[model samples]
Each structure stands twice: as C-alpha cells, then as structure tokens.
Target chain A: MRGAVIYAPGDVRFENLDDPKIINPTDAIIRTVATCVCGSDLWPYRGAEPIGDPHPMGHEYVGVVEEVGSEVANVRPGQFVVGSFATSDNSCANCLNGWQSSCLHREFMSTCQADYVRIPNAHGTLVATDEHPDAELVPSLLAVSDVMGTGWYAAVAAEVKPGSTAVVVGDGAVGLCGVIAAKELGAERIITMSRHESRQKLAREFGATDIIAERGDAGVARVKDLTGGIGADSVLECVGTSEAMRQALHSARPGGNVGFVGVPHEVAIDGEELFFSHVGLRGGPAPVRRHLPDLIDRVLTGRINPGKVFDLTLPLDQVAEGYRAMDERRAVKALLKP
Target chain B: MRGAVIYAPGDVRFENLDDPKIINPTDAIIRTVATCVCGSDLWPYRGAEPIGDPHPMGHEYVGVVEEVGSEVANVRPGQFVVGSFATSDNSCANCLNGWQSSCLHREFMSTCQADYVRIPNAHGTLVATDEHPDAELVPSLLAVSDVMGTGWYAAVAAEVKPGSTAVVVGDGAVGLCGVIAAKELGAERIITMSRHESRQKLAREFGATDIIAERGDAGVARVKDLTGGIGADSVLECVGTSEAMRQALHSARPGGNVGFVGVPHEVAIDGEELFFSHVGLRGGPAPVRRHLPDLIDRVLTGRINPGKVFDLTLPLDQVAEGYRAMDERRAVKALLKP
Candidate 1:
C-alpha cells in the first residue's frame, strides 16, 4: 500500500507501506476514497511541530468499508461512511455524555492520509449513509470526518444563538466552515477576518455578513463597529496563535462567550483581564464525535455545502501538491482522491 | 452622619462625619437600619491590601428611603427597601441583560457604611417591599442586599443542576450562602469544605449534605469519594486564593461549570487543562443587581435565612471591634445595628 509519511521536519513522502490488519474486535478497514490536507497538517510539515518518526500524515478522510471485524456492529462492509478523526468505543461514560474524543479508550487516526486506513472502534466512529454518495459530495463528507465537525463544535461551544453577532478569528478551512456553522446555527451576523481573497470569498459565501481585511486590532475594531460598539456576542478563536487568541478575547462584550477550538501552543490566559471582563472560555479539541451526526444530516439534506472549502483537488499520487497549494496560499482547502 | 472609616492598615474607627449630599439627579438618601462586616472586609483589616488615607469600609447594608431626588420614581420616601451592594439603573443594556454590577453608571455603596447613605439611580437600585418588614426577617432581608444575591449568582453561573453533586470551596459567609443557593437551585448533593465550626454549622443548616474539613487536595479527594469517583457536576469557588481556584477547577466533572465569585487575588487559568477537560468558567463580582429582587422575595417568603451566617453582633459605634473580630477569624460574619 502507498501512504503519505512524515519522515522528519520539513519532510513528507508518498512511500510504499505495509497494509494494516484488524487488531481489535471493533476494528474495520477503510479504503480511502477522499483525503484532505488540514491546517493542523502544517504543524509538522513546516517543522513547527517535532516529528516523532516517519509517521502517519493525515487525520481527515472519508472512505468505503472494505472489511469489518467480528464485533463491529453498526458499520458493515461495502458501505460508504463518514467518521470522526478520533476513534472511541461508543459505550463509555464519556462517550455517552457526548464527548467521544475523551472516551476512556480513545484512539487517534492522525495517519489516515493513506489509501487504506484501519479504524478502531469502528462501530462507534463511523456513521453510515443511506447510500453511496456521488463523487461531488465526497469532499464535503470527508470534512464531516474532522475539520467540519470541529468548526461546528466551535460555534456550538461559543453558544451561537439566533440573531446573535459572531466573530470568527481564523480563515483556514475550519475557520471558513465555522462561519458556515454559525450561520447554520442561526447566527444573524457573521464576521470573519481574512486578508486572502479566496478565503474571504468563501467566508462571504458561507454567510459572513461582513469581512475584515485587517489582522488583529483593525479586525477587532471592525467587529466592534459592526456590532454598534458592543462587540460580538460570541467569538470563535480558530487560530492557535497568541495574537489570535487575544484578538478573539478582546473582540467580545464584557459578558460574552469565547469558544476557542485552536489547539493552544504557548498560550497564557491573563488572570486579571479575564476575571474583570467576565468572558467565559469553553473549548478544546473538536469533540467531533458529538457533532458528526448533525453534520452528516446537514450534508445529506444539502443544508450546508461545506465541501466548497476544498477549492482545489488532485489525485492521491499528487497529495504532495495538496499540501503545497494550501501552504503557498493558492487554495482555501485542497482535497485528494485515492 | 457617622460612618466606619479605615485610617490605615489595622485601624478602623466609627465616628461622626459630614452627611452625604446627592451628586446626581438620580440619587437618594437612605437611613441605614443594618450594615454588616463582610469576609472581604478582612483583606484591608489584615493588611493584605494596602491602606491609603482614611477610606470608607463595608459594602453590604439594608436601609430605608429617607429622601428621594426629583427623578427618583420607583422608590419613594419612607419606603422599606433593600438595594444591591452596587447601585445600578435597571435601564442600561448591561443591567437589563442581567449584569448590573457592570452598568455604565453603577456606583458602589461602600462609601455609605454610615448612619445615612446617598444612593445613585434610586429608581433602578432600590426595590420597595410591602410596608415595613416583620422583625424576624430583618437579618434575612439584609442578606438579600449582597451576600445571598452574590451566592445565588455564583450558583446560577456555575450551572448547578437539579440533582447533581456540587462542591463549594470556601467557608466564608458567601460560601455558606452558596450552600443555601445551591440547595435552593436544586442541587441534590452539596459538599462544603470548612475547618471552622461555626461556618460548618451554617453550611449544614443551609442544606450542605456533607462536610470536608481538609483544605485543598484532600478536600477534593473527599468530594470525589462522596460522588463515587466522578467529580461534582458544578463547583462554586468562593475563595480568591489561587489554590482554591485550582481546587475548584479540579473538583468538577468533565464538561462541568465553575462559578467563581471571590474577588480573585492571583489566579492563572491553564489553557491546556481547561481546553482538554472541557470545563467552563464564568464569574466575577456577582451580578448582584440581577438577583436582588428574587432574593428579597425569598427572604420575605422565609425560604432562606441568610442572616444565620453572622454569629456576632455589635452596635455601629464599635465597628472597629467588628472588623478586628473578622480579621482575627473570631467571627465568621458580623452584623451591626446602626
């Protein structure tokens, strides 16, 4: 089997790899139909993150079930499915409470950028559609597997309400989809900050009522002006940078909510400012499992076509270019078909 | 008028001074019936906080309307009333949204800890009761002025569930009343940490189901054991110490809420822990204005007896001794008859 591997910092390769076999009773093998480059993929790709070894390179994908283990109950062979990036047994207390990402026996599928990926806890992780989706819906369904679900969680965690003003601080694919999620969740006004034309266009199309071309202060000021100086009722911090986090915090009203989905890297919360301002922070890794079912419904019903974020597509053999297009800012998102 | 003044650290004196005059058209003069020593009062008394020139002390009181300014409409002359510790016009957006402490023209009454207090925004700040209150309800009505209202806000901000376990991390008057608020809010199990006998008794009388004498980790462990290894569904942090804040955060179940009302001295939030654990934090100076009316009704109906927190009493002339007793931990809370 050929798979994408991260050999070291600033190194990525498509190499022949040994195929995976079922190791758990709830496991299943997926033949990858579509995979995509994630904004988080830039971490190790650009050497910002330390590479453990030549490792699995992708965490977002949608595929067909080629095989299922004996104990796998919900999913079956030869079915089209969407799954969360993280795998977990659905029966655990944490999973029952809608936090499958923190399930007692959670597993990460950060290497699913391969042709054939093995899924643990398959019955709980994968959601089967009524029928196989057309090639057009493939990218959108793949998004529900990770980034889309994450963005939706960000909106929900921020407690986006009907007719509320929402500020989204990142313009990556997930951030663009956060605008979509906020809109779908009934936010009356959505403001996204982005200097790039491609992302800004998609953000507007995804229901952003306004766009701020500035990065930090200007962006937050524009948001404040748009909201009549009250700031946003809900702010989503999709970028993990300290500046982005601060901008998100500063862009909210005194008693507003901040749903931060960006993976924090060297972030420090100012105790005094937070204590006095009364802004509540509620976020973490996208509880993708908790949101997958709703996202799948949106996709199936064509209520939200989030896969439009993938403006560029290529064959699995050209997965290297998928990363390059996103890294070089030529595309808002890139999808690869296996 | 005579008022309580702090000349310096460890120096409190009750003495006659010039009577307060209205500075705004919305102001009114009130004759104080009772004023109390708060847990926060000990900060300056113990010299934990710096002393400037002689400053007024005490933020909680219940009084009668002696005079009303031209624009005062809601409260009238000679009406028995209770007002929030922080006065606010109920008309502002922040106040209307239930965050009155942060109202644009809000004023604190700490400077009015004398025989007569000049309150601003009397129409929004004061709520008149049915004629004079019965004698037995004075202490309870006085509590609705500040501590009980703040504790109720803490419990609501913490999102206390109808039948879930909750942990209160401070043994002060507000913490004891948090036990009352938690129970009144329908928390089935209440665990209060207290080493002081008087506070423990008050907490139990207010419906604390269990008591943990240990301070930090041991206290958290005791709570966990009581809840069958699962942490409490809600945590009320009524102590401002970083240690108490950390304990409160650690004592909640994943996806739980922590309502912090203590004026934070120095506390830092760990972004990683908060994000990964999915815990929520929302609190500040309690939105006392938002809860005052309902609390007053609770007091009037005899559903709560918040005045039980004060075990010591004194006349206004001995305000110095009142501060000393609280600073020395000799009284959990002190009440003064003006």
Candidate 2:
C-alpha cells in the first residue's frame, strides 16, 4: 500500500507502506475509495505545528469495506461507507448524549490517505450507504465524513435559526461549507468574511448574502453595520486562531451564539470580556458521527453540493502535490483518488 | 438622607448624604423600604476591588415610589416596587432579545443603601406590585431584585431541563438561590458544593439533594462519581474567582452547560482546553428585569423564600455593622431596614 508521510516541514513524500490489519475485534479494514487533504493538514505541512517522527497523514475518507473483525456487524465486506475523523463506540454515554467526538473509547482516524486503512470502532463509526452511488457523488460523500459534517456542527453550535442572521469566519473549505449549512438551516442572512476573490465567489454561490474583506476592528464594524448596530444572531468561527476567535465573539449580538470548530492554537479567552459580551460559546471537534446519516442523505438527495469545495483533484500517488497546492493557496481543497 | 459609604477597605461608615433627585424624564425617586448587603459587596470591603473615593454603596432594594418624572408612567408615586441593579430601556434591541442587562441605555444602580434613590429607565426597570405586600414577604421581594434573579438567570443559561442533573458551585446567597432555581426548573438532582455547615444546611433546605464539600480536583472527582462518571448536566457558577470558574467547567459533562453569574475577577480561560471539553459556556450579569415579575410572583405566592439567605438584620442607621458582619463571614447575608 502507498500513503503520504510527513518527514519534516514542507517535506511530504509518497512512499510504499505495509497494509493495515485489524488489531481489535471492533476494527475493520477499508480499501480507500476517496480521500482528501484538509486545511488542517497545512498546520504540520507549513511547520506551524510540530512534526515529530515520520507518520502517515489524513483523516477524511469515503471507502469500501475490504474486511471486518468478528465483532463488527454494522458494516461489512464490500459495502461503500462514510465515517468521521473521530471514531466512537456509538453506545457510550457521551455518544448517547450526541457528543460522539468525546466518546470515552474514541480514536481519531489518521493514515487514511492510503490504499487501505484500518478503522477502529468500525461497528459504530461506519455508516454504509444502501448501494454505491454514481462516481461523481464521491467528493460530496467524502465531505460528509468531516468538513461538511463539521460545518453542520458549527451551525448547530451557533444555534442558527430560521429568519436569523449568521456570520461565518474564515474562507477555508469548512467556512464555505458552513455557509451552505447556515442556508440549509434556514438562516435568512449569511455573512462570510473572506479576502480571497475566488473563495468569496464560492461562498456567494453557497448562499452568502454579504462578505466583509476587512479583518480586525473594521470587520466587526461592518458586521455591526449590517446587523443594525448590534451583531449577527450566530457566528461560525471556522479558523483556529486568536484573531478569528475574537472576530467571531465580537460579531455576535448579546444573547447570540458563537460556534467555533477550528482547532485553537494558543488562544486565551478573558473571562471578564466574554461575560460582558453576553455571548454564548460552544466549540470543539465536530461530533461528525452524530450527523453522518443525515448529511449523507442530504448529499445523495442533491439538496446540497458540498463537493464544490474541492477545486483541485489528484491521483493518490501525487498526494504531495495536493498538500502543496492547498498550502500555497492555489486550491481551496484537493480531492485525492486512491 | 443617610447611606453607607466606603472610604477605604474595611472602613464602611454610616454618613449623611444628599437626597437623590430625578435627573431624567424617565427617572423615579423611591423611598427605601428595604436594601441588603450582597456577596459582591464583600469584594470592595475586603480590598479585593479598588475604592477610589468615598461613595454611596448598595444596589439591591425594594422601595415605595416617592416621586416620578413627567415621563414615568409604569409606576406612580406611593406604589410599592421591585427593581433590578441594572436598569434598562425595555424597548432596546438587546432588551427585546431578553438580555436587559445588555440594553443599549443600561445604567447600574449603585446608591440604593441611602434613604432615597433615583431610578433611571424607571418605566422599564421598576415592576410595581399590585398593592403593599405583607411584612413577611418583604425580604423575599427584596431578594428577587438581585440574588434570586441572578440565580434564575444562571439556571436558564445552563438550560436546566426536567430530569437533568444540576451542580451549584459556591455556597453564597446566589448559589443557595441557584439550588432553588434548579429545583423549580425540574432538575431531578441538585448537587451543591459548600464547606460551611450553615450554608450547607441552607442549601439542603433549598432543594440541594447532594452536598460535596471537597474543593478543586477532589470536588470534581466527587461530582463525576455521582453523575455516572460523566459530570452533571448543568453547572451554575455563582462564585467569580478563577478557581470557581474552573470547578464549574470541570464539573459538567461533555456537551453540558455552565451558567456563570459571578462577575469574574482576572480569570482567563484557555480556548484549547474548553474546545476539547465540548462544554457550552454562557455567563454575564443576570438580566434581572427580565425575570423580576415572575420572581416577584413566586415570592408573593410563597413558592420560594430566598430571603432566608439573610441571617442578620440591622436598622438602616447600623449599615456599617451589616458590612462588617458580611465581610467577616459571620453572616451569609445582611438585611437593612431604612
């Protein structure tokens, strides 16, 4: 099997690796059908995040089951499936409460950018489609595994409602998908913060009613201006930076909500400031498994086309190029074929 | 008129003060019927907060309207009323959104310990009773102005639901009232953290089903054990210190909520830690005006008795003794008669 491995900053290589095997009775081995390089992947690729010891990368996939452990009954051999970046046992207390990302026996998926990948807690994590769909739907289905699912979580956390206003921070793939989610959730107005012309166009296509190119205080002023001197009813923070968090918090009206999905880095929130703002905040890794069935259905039903986020595609062997294109801002996201 | 003035830390003195007068068309002057020392007031008395110059203190009061400006119509002269510490124009956007504390024209009441106090935004901030209430209900009515209202807001922000488990951090008057709120909101179990025997007894009387005296890590462990290894469904943080905030956050299960009412002092929350916890956080000064009517009704109907939190009562002329007792922790709270 071949997979992408990170040796150091900007040093990704396509190398042959041993095929994964089931290590637990709850595990299953899936032959990767579709995979992708995510914006989060750039964290290590750009040296923003530490990379220690060479390891396989990737956490998004739509694959076909090759084999299953004895205990895995929900998904079996030959079934096309979608799974979340974070695997859960489905029946744990946290999972029952609809927070599968915090499942007691949770394991985050990595090493998915390969021909074959071993899935832990497969019986609970994998949701098999009734039948394999048309090839063109692969990208959207793969998106339902992470980015799209995450976007949905962001909207839910922000408590977006019909006839309410929503603001999306960050123009990355997740933020673009968030625009779609907010629209689908019945938000009357969708505002996205994006400076890149191409990304702004895509955001508008996804139902953004307004766009603010300004970044700090000026951006907040624009949001307040649009929101009648207050702020939006909901703000989806899709970037994991202190500046993005501050913008998201500032863009919400008192009693409004800010749902942050980006993995925060060195962000410290002042308790007094947050209290005075009177904004509700809830953020974490998206509980994708909890929304898998509904999102996959949305994709198959043609109600939403999140696949548009992938502006570039590459063969699995050229995964290095996929990372490079996204890192250099040449592609919003790159879909990889395995 | 007479009032309690704080000239320095531990130096509260009963002094003559100028009578308050209506300065705005929406203002009303109320003759003080009752006012009380608050847990927050201890901060200034203990030197935890700066005291620039001698100033009239106190923000909680139940009084009779002595005079009304030309624009005041909701309550007329001689009407008994209950008012919040924070006054607001009810027609503002934030007030209409149920966040009166964040109202556009909000003004915090700070001279209520005096014989007479001017009320700003009186048309929206004062809720007049149908008639003079029995003397027995005066204490409870006074509590509704702040402590009880704050506790109710905490329960609401935490989203307490029927059959859910709730935890109250802090054993002060607000925390005790929080226990009452959780019970009223239909929480099946209420856990209160308190080290003081008297406060523990009071908490139990206020519907606290369990009490954990442990602090810090041990306290959180106890909460987890009682909540089936996950924390409580909702946690009401009534103390403002960093330690209290951390305890409240850690005492809730993933996806649970923490409604913090304490005015935080120099507290900073790490964004990454909060994100991984999957907990929802919402905190602010309570929108007392929003809950005034309901709380007043509860008090008058004998459904709750938050006034029990006041263990020491003093004549208005002995205001200094009231402050001294509360500052020394000799009384849970002090009630004053003007």
Candidate 3:
C-alpha cells in the first residue's frame, strides 16, 4: 500500500509501505476511502513541530471496515464508517463522559494515510452509517474524523445558545465548520473573521451572518459593533497565535465564553486580564468521537456538506503534493483518495 | 471620625478623619457598627502590595445608615444595614445579570475602616434584616458584608454541585467561609488544606469533612486519593499564590471547575498546564452586592455563621491594633467596633 510518511521537518513523502493488519482483538482493519491533510499536520510539515523519524502520516479518514476483530461487537466488516482522529475504548470513564479524545485507552490513528490501517478500540472509535451512501458524501464523512467534530466541539464548549452572537477567529476549515456548528446550535449571529474568499464564501453558505476582514483591534471593534458594543456572547479561537487569542479575548462580552480549540503555541494568559474580563476559557483536544456519530448523520441527511473545505484532491501516491499545496497556501485543505 | 489608614508598609495608624456625607442622590452615609480587617488587607500592610500614600482601609462593614440621599428609596436613615464591599447601581444590565461587581456604576468600598463612610448605589449595596437582632447577630451581619458574600461567590464560581467533592486551597477567613458556602450549595464532601489549628477548627465547623496538611503535589495527591484518584469536582483557590493555583489545578478532576477568589498578585498562568489539565478557571472580584441579600438572609436565619473567623476584637480607637494582630498572623481576622 502507498502511504505518506514524515521523515523530518518539511519532508513529507509518499512511498510504498507494508499493509496494516489487525494486531489486537479490539482493532479493525479499515480500507481508506478518503484521507486529508490537517492544519495541525502543517505544524510539522512547516518545521514548526519537530519531526523525529519516518513516522506514519494522516489521521483523518472515511473508510470501510474491511475486517473486524472478534472483540468489536458494534461495527462489522463491509460497513461504511467515519472514525474519529483518535481511537478510543468506549468503556473508559472519560469516554463514558463523552470525551473520547481523552479516553483512558486511546491511540492516535496517524497511519490512516495508507490504503489499509488498523483501528484500535474499533467498537468505540468508528460510527457507521445505516447504509452506504454514494461517493459524493465521502469528503464530508472524511471531515467527521477531525475538523467537523472539532468545530462542533468548539461550539458546544463555547456554550453557544439560541439568540446568541458568536465570533469565529479563524477562517480555515475548522472555523468554517464551526460556523455551521454554531448555526446548528442556534446562535443568532455568526461572525467569521476571514481574509480568504473561498473560506469566506463557504462560511457564509454555512450560516455566517457577518464577516469582518480586519484583524486585531479593528476585528474586535467590528465584533463589538455587531454585538451592540457588548462583544459576541461566544468567541471561538481556532488560530493558535498570541494575537489571535488576544483578539478572541477582546471579542467576547464580560460574561461570555471563549472556546479556544487552537493548539496554543507559546500562548501567554495574563491573569489580570482574564480576571477583569470575567470571561470563561474552555476547550482542549476536542472530543471528536462524541460528535462523529451525529456529524456523520448530518452529512448523510444533506443538512451540511463540509467537504467544501477540500479545495484540492489527489491519489494517495501524491499525498506529498497535497501537503505542498497546503504548505504553500494554495489549498484550504487537500483530500487524498486511497 | 476615627479611621484606620495605611501610611506605609507596616505602618497602619488610627487617626481622626472627616466624617463622610452623602454626595449623590443614591448615596448614604453610614456610621459603622462593626468592621473587619480582611485577608487581602494584610497584603498591603505586609508590604506585599504597594502602599502608595496614607490610604483609608477596609472594604467590610455592618453599619447604621445615619443619612440617606434623596434618591435612596429602599434604604432610609437610622437603619441597621449590611452592605457589600462593592457598591453598584441595581438598575444596570450587568447588575441585573447578577454581576454587580462589574456594574456600570460600581464603587469599591475600600475607605470603610472609618467611623463614618459614604455608601454609593445604596439601593443595591445595603440589605437590612427584618428587625435589628441582639448583639450576637451583629457579627453574622458583618460577615454578610464581604467574607460571606465572597465565599458564596467562590462556591458559585466553582460550581459546587450536589454530591460533588470540593477542595479549598486556603485556610483564611474566605476559605473557611468557602467551606460553609460549599456546604450550603450542596457539596457532599469538602477538603480543605489547613496548617493552622484555628482556621482548621473553623473550617471543620463550617463543614469541612477532610483536611490535608500537604502543600502542593502531596495535597493534590491526598485529595485524589480521597476521591478515588479522580480528583475533586470543584476546587476553590482562595490563597492568591501561584502554588495555591497550581495545587488547585492538580486537585481538580479533568473537566472540573476552579473558582479562584484570591486577589491575584503577580501570578503567571501557564497555558499548557491549564489546557492539559482541562480545568476551567472562573472568578474575579466577588459580585458581593449580588449575593448580599441571600447571604444576609442566611445569616439572619442562622443558616451560616461566617463570623467564627473573626478571632480578635478591638474598639474603633484601637484600629491600629486590629491591623497589627492580623498582619502578624496572631488572629485569623480582626473585628473592630465603633
């Protein structure tokens, strides 16, 4: 099978690799239907996060269960499924609490870029559809693996309610999906800060009532203006930059919530500012498995088509090209079919 | 009028000062019945916080309204009243939202250590008992002025749900009151870290079921052990130290709430630690005015007695002695009577 591998920083390669097999009874072999590059993947591809060795790449995929271990009681072979970015044991206390991303027995599915991959804790990790849908729904189902679930988690974490105003900080795939999530959660006014036309257009299509192209103070001021000077009731920070985090902080009302899903990169939280602001900060690694089921259902029902985020597509053998397009800012996200 | 003023570090003096007079239509002048030195006040007296000039001290007091301005419709002259540390216009949106401390018209009553003090936004700040009780209830009413309200805010902020375990990180009066607040809020188990026998006794009396003498890691471990290694559902950091904050973080279960009421002093927050721990930090200056009514009712009904924290007592002329005792740690808190 051909798979993507990260040998070192800025060195993502596609080459023939050994096919994965079910190594544990709780694991299932998934034949990848579609896989994609993540913004977080750019962290290492751009040499921001250190890459140690020729590691297996990709964690987002919509696949068919080619084989299931004896212990996997919920999902069976030949079933179309959308698994979370991370595999989780359904019985763990954390998983039971609906935070499967931090399940006690969890493993990252980094090797999903290959044609076939072993999914540990398969019973809990994958959410299968009632029946197989056409190929058009593959990209949207693929999104269920990470970005869609994450964006949904951002909305849930922010406590976005009916008649609420929400500000989405990033215009990337997750932010676009977050706009959709907030709208689904009944937020009255959804504002996305975007300088990109493609993401902006998709965001508007996903129920964004307002868009502010300005950054920093102007962005915060525009959000405040949209919220009648009280700022948004909920602010979602999807970009992991100090300035972006600050803008998110300044974009929320005094009693509002800020759900920051962006991986904090050298972020400094000033205690005095947080104290005086009286805002709540919540959200970490999203509980993607918790949302995968509903998100996949939403995709199948034509409620939302998150696959619009994939601006480019390539065969699995050209995974490196997909990464290059994203790294060079040519695509919002690149989809790879295996 | 006699007042306690901080001229410099370790130099709190009792001296004559001009009596306060009503300035605003919503203002009232109160002759203090009883006032207490707070844990935060010692920071300035101990040279921890800057003592700029000879500043009038105290933010906690129970008094008689000697004069009421024209717009003071709710409160009248010659009434015994318990007022919060913060004075707020009850009509503002923020105040109506139960965050009076952040009200549009809010004034902190730091100059209330004097014999006569001006109370702003009298309609919102002062709450009176149905009838003036005996001398014993005066102490309880004094508690409602600040400490009790702060403790209740900490409990509310931490979200001490019923059947949940709560860990408090300080042994001061506020922490002791936090134990009481947690119990009133339906917390089943209260674990408090106390090295002092006096405060420990008060905490136990206030409903602390467990006490851990360990400081940071060990204290958190003890709490985890007590909670079957799951940590507490809620944690209250009342000691404004980075160590206490860290301990609070380590003591909470993942996705637990942390209500920090300690006035932060040069504390740096680590984003990674907070993010990985999944602890929600929420707090600020207690919305004392918002809780003053219920706290006063509780005190009057003999539901909670926060005045147990007042270990030392002094006359108005001996205001300096009250500061000295509290600053030297000879008293958990000092109560001064005019």
Candidate 4:
C-alpha cells in the first residue's frame, strides 16, 4: 500500500506503506475507494500546526469495507460506506446528544489518504449506503464523510431558518458547502465573503445570494450595510482564524447566531464584545456524524452536488501534488483516488 | 427630589436632586414606587468598575407614571408600570428580534433610586399593569423590572426545556431567580451552586432540586458527577467572572446551552476551550424588556415570588445602607422605598 506522509513543513511524500488491519473487535478494514485533501491539511502542510515527526496524512474518505472484526455489526465486507472524520462509539451520552465528535470513545481517523485504512468503532462511525455508489456519485458521497456534513452542521448550529439572511465568512470548500447547507435549511438570503473569482462563482452556484470581496472590519461592515445596518440574521464562521471569528461575530445582528465550525487557532474573544454582541456562539470540531444520515440521503437522491467542490482529482500516487494544488489555492478541494 | 450618587468607590450619598422632567418627546416621568440595589452595583462600590464622577446610582425600579411625553402611547400617567434597567425604544431591529438591551435607542435608567426619574423611550420600555398593585404584590412586580426578567432571559436563552437538567452558576438574587425561571420553563432538575446557608435555603425554595457548595472546577465536576458524567443540559451563568464563565461552560454537556446574563468584568474566553466544549454560549446584558410582560403577569397573578430575593428594605435616604448591605453580602438584595 502507498500513503502520504508529512516529514516537515512543505514536505510530503508518497511511498509504499504497510496496509492497515482491524485491530479492535469493533473495527473494520476498508480499502480506500476515494479520499481527499482537506483545508485543515494545509495547517500542517504549511507548518502552522506543529509537526515534530513524519506523520500519516488525511482523515476524510469514502470506501468499501474489505473486512470487519468480530464485533462489527452495522457494516459488512464489500459494503460502501461514509464515516465522520472523528470515529465514535455513537452510544455515549454526547453521541446520543448529537455531539459525536465528543463521544466518550472517540478516535481520530488518520492516514486514510491511502489504499487501506482501519476504522475504529465501525458500527457507530460508518453509515453504509444501500449499495456501491455510482462512480460519479463517489466524490459527493466522500464529502458526506466530512466537509459536507461539517457545512451542514454549521448551518444547523447557526440556526438557519426560513427567511434568515445568512453570512458565510470564508470561501474555502467548507464555506461553499455551507452555502448549500444554508439554502437547504431554507435561508432566503445567503451572503458569502469571497475575494476569489472562481470560489465566488462556486459560492453563487451553491446558492449564495450575494458576495462581498472585502475582509476584516470592511467585510463585516459590508454585511451590515447589506442587511440594513443590522447585520445578517445568521453568520456561519467557516474560517478558524481570530480575524475570521471576529468578523463572524460582528457580522451578526444583536440577537443573531454565529455558528463557527472552523478549527480555531490562536483565537481569543473579549468578554465585553461577546457580551454586547448578543449573538449566540456555538461551534468546535463539528459533530459531522450527526448530519451524515440526512446528507447521505440528500446526496444519493440527487438533491445536492457537493462533489463540485473537488475541482482537482488525482491518482493516489500524485497525492503530493494534490496537497500542492490546495496549498497554493489552485483548487477548492482535491479528490484522490486510491 | 432625592437620589443616590456614587462619588467614588465605597462612597454612596443620598441627597437632594432636581426633579426629573420629560425632555425628550419619547420620555416619561415616573415616581419611584420601589428600587433595588443590584449585584452589578457592587462592581462600582467595590471599585471594580471605576467611578470618575458623582454619578447617579440605581437602574432597577418599578414606578407609577407621573407624566408622559406627548408621543408616549404604551404607558400613561398614574399607571403602575415596570421597565427594564436598560430602556429601549423596542422599535429597532434588535428589539424586534428580542434583544431590547441592544436597541438603537437604548438608555440606562440611572438615578432610579429617587422620588422621580425621567425614562427615555417610555412608550417602548414601560409595560403598565391593569391596576395599582397591593403592597404584597409590589415587591414581586418590582423584581420583574430587572432581576426576575434577567433570570428568565437566562433560562430562555439557555433553552431550558421539559425534562432538561438545568444548573445555575451563582446563588445571588439573579441566580436564585434563575432556579425559579428554570422550573417555570419546565426543567426537571435544577442544581444551584451556593455555599451560603441562607442562599441555599432560598435556592431550594425557588425550585433547586440540588445544591452544590463547591466553586470553580469542583462545582463543574460535581455537576458532571450528578448527570452521569455528561454535565447539565442547560447552564445559567449569573456570575460574570472568568472563573464562573469557565465553570458554566465546563458544567454543560456537549451540545448544551449556557445563558450568561452576568455583566462581565475582566473576563476573556479562550476560543479553543469554548470551541471544543461544543457548548452554545449566548449572553450579554439581558433583554429584560423582552420578558417583562409575561413575568409581570406571573408576578401579578402570584405565580412566583421573586421579590423574596430582597431580604432587606430601607427608605430612599438609606440608599447608602442598601448598597452596603449587598456589597457586604449581608443581604441577597436590598429594596429601597422612595
């Protein structure tokens, strides 16, 4: 098997690696059908996330189960499935509360950007499709494993409602998917902040009613200006940076909601500002698993095409270039076929 | 007329002041029937909130309308009424969205511990009762002016629902009132954090099913211990300190909600912790006016006795003693008669 490894910042290699095998009674061995480079991957690739040693890459994938341990019951060999980036037992109180990412027996699914992967807690983490998906539907199905579900969580956390004006604070793949989620959730006016032409086009296609090229305070001002100086009713914070979080907070009306799904880095919120903002703030590592069932249904029924976010696809051997394309902003998302 | 002034920390003076007159077309003059010293007032009295000049004190009051500006319509002269500490026009987008504290035309009702006070935005701020209230009903109705309404907002914002386990983080007047609000909102289990015997007694009377004397991490740990290690379903944060906020966040189950009505001082939230907690945080100055009508009804109908939070009563001339009693923790609250 061949997998991608990051030895250092700007250092990625694709080389032969040992295949994964089910070690736990509840685990499943899956032969990767498709995987992708995540926007979060850029954090470690660019050295923004500390990396002391070479590490396995990728946490997002849709695959066919090749084998399952004795305790695996929900999924079987040869079944195609999509799972959340974070694996969970799914029976814990947190999981029962729809916060699977915080489940008691949670584990990170890493190195899935390879030929084979071992998924722990298979019965709880993997959502099996009725059958192997059509070749063209694979990418969209793969998105349900992470990005699409994350976007959907963002919309739901922001409480997007039938007539809400939602503002999305990023133009990355997740942000574009958020536009789709907000639209599906019945948001009437979707405003996306995007400075890139291609990304803006994708955002609009995904149901963004307006686009603002501005950043920082100006971007927030633009949102307020568009919403009659009261800010949007719901703001989806898809970027994790402090500035992005600030913008998201400032871009909401006094009693609006800011659903922040970005993996925050070096973000500090002033109590005074948040107190006065009167905006409901909720986010974290998205409980993507919570939205998987519905998103999978929507995808299989041809209701949404989130797969369009994967503008770049490469063979597993060229995973290095997949990382490069996304790191350089040449692709919104990179789909890798193993 | 007479009012209380804070010339400096620990310096409160009750002295003669000019009678208030309706200056704005939207203003109304009200003769104070009852005013109270708030937990928030201790901030200035303790020198936590700087006082640069001899500023008027008191912001919570229930009064009888003495005169109404020509444009005022919702309230009229001689009517017994209650208004939020923060007066709002109630016509702004924020107010319409249920965040009256952030209304475009918001004015803090200072000099309220006086014989008469001019209320701005009276038409939108004041809610008049059907008739003059009996002496016994006056205290409870006065609570609807601020503390009770704030507690109700905390419960509502925290999304306390039927069968939910709710936790109140402080045992001050507002926190005790939160227990009552949580019960009224259909919370099945109410846990209030209190170390003082008197406050704990009041907490129980207000519907606290359990009381935790621990503070900070221990309190949070106790809550998790009580809820099968998952924490409370909803947490009402009535103390504004960083420690209290942190505890409130930690005390809630993942995906739980925290309604914080504390006037924060020196509180800074770490974005990473909040994001990972998966706790919904919504707070600020309570939009008390939003809950006034319903709270007033409950008070007038004797459904709740939030006024019991005021353990001491003093004449307007003893306003300094009222502040001293609350600041010294000798009283949970102090009601001033003008």
DockQ of each: 0.61, 0.93, 0.57, 0.87
TM match of model 1 to true structure: 0.96
Q: DockQ-based ranking, best first? A: 2, 4, 1, 3
Candidate 4 Cα misplacement greater than 4 A, ranges? none
Chain A TM-score (model 1): 0.98
Candidate 1 versus truth, CA RMSD in Å, comes to 1.8
Which residue runs of candidate 3 sit more than 4 Å off their true CA positions?
A: none
**Candidate 2 C-alpha lDDT tens digits along B282-312:** 9999999999989999998899999999999
- Name the docking class for model 2: high
Question: Each model's C-alpha lDDT?
Answer: 0.85, 0.95, 0.86, 0.92
TM-scores for all predictions: 0.96, 0.99, 0.96, 0.99
For residues A242-303, could you state the per-residue lDDT of candidate 1 as single tens digits? 89888998888767889988887778776667766777778877778888888888998899
- TM match of model 3 to true structure: 0.96
iRMSD (1 decimal) for each model? 1.4, 0.4, 1.5, 0.8
**lDDT tens digits, residues B1-338, model 3?**
88988998888888888888788899999889999899889888888988887889999988888999898888777789888888888777677767788778989889888899899898778877667767988887888788878888888888899998999999988898899999999999999999988888889899999999998788888998998776888998898887888898789886788888888777777765666666777878888877887888888788988888889988877878888898778998888998
lDDT tens readout by residue for model 1, B33-58: 88888877787778788877888887
lDDT of 3 at A141: 91
Q: Candidate 3: deviation at residue A219, Å?
A: 1.9
Q: For model 2, how does the per-residue alpha-carbon lDDT over A147-211 read when each residue is reduced to its tens digit?
A: 99999999999999999999999999999999999999999999999999999999999999999
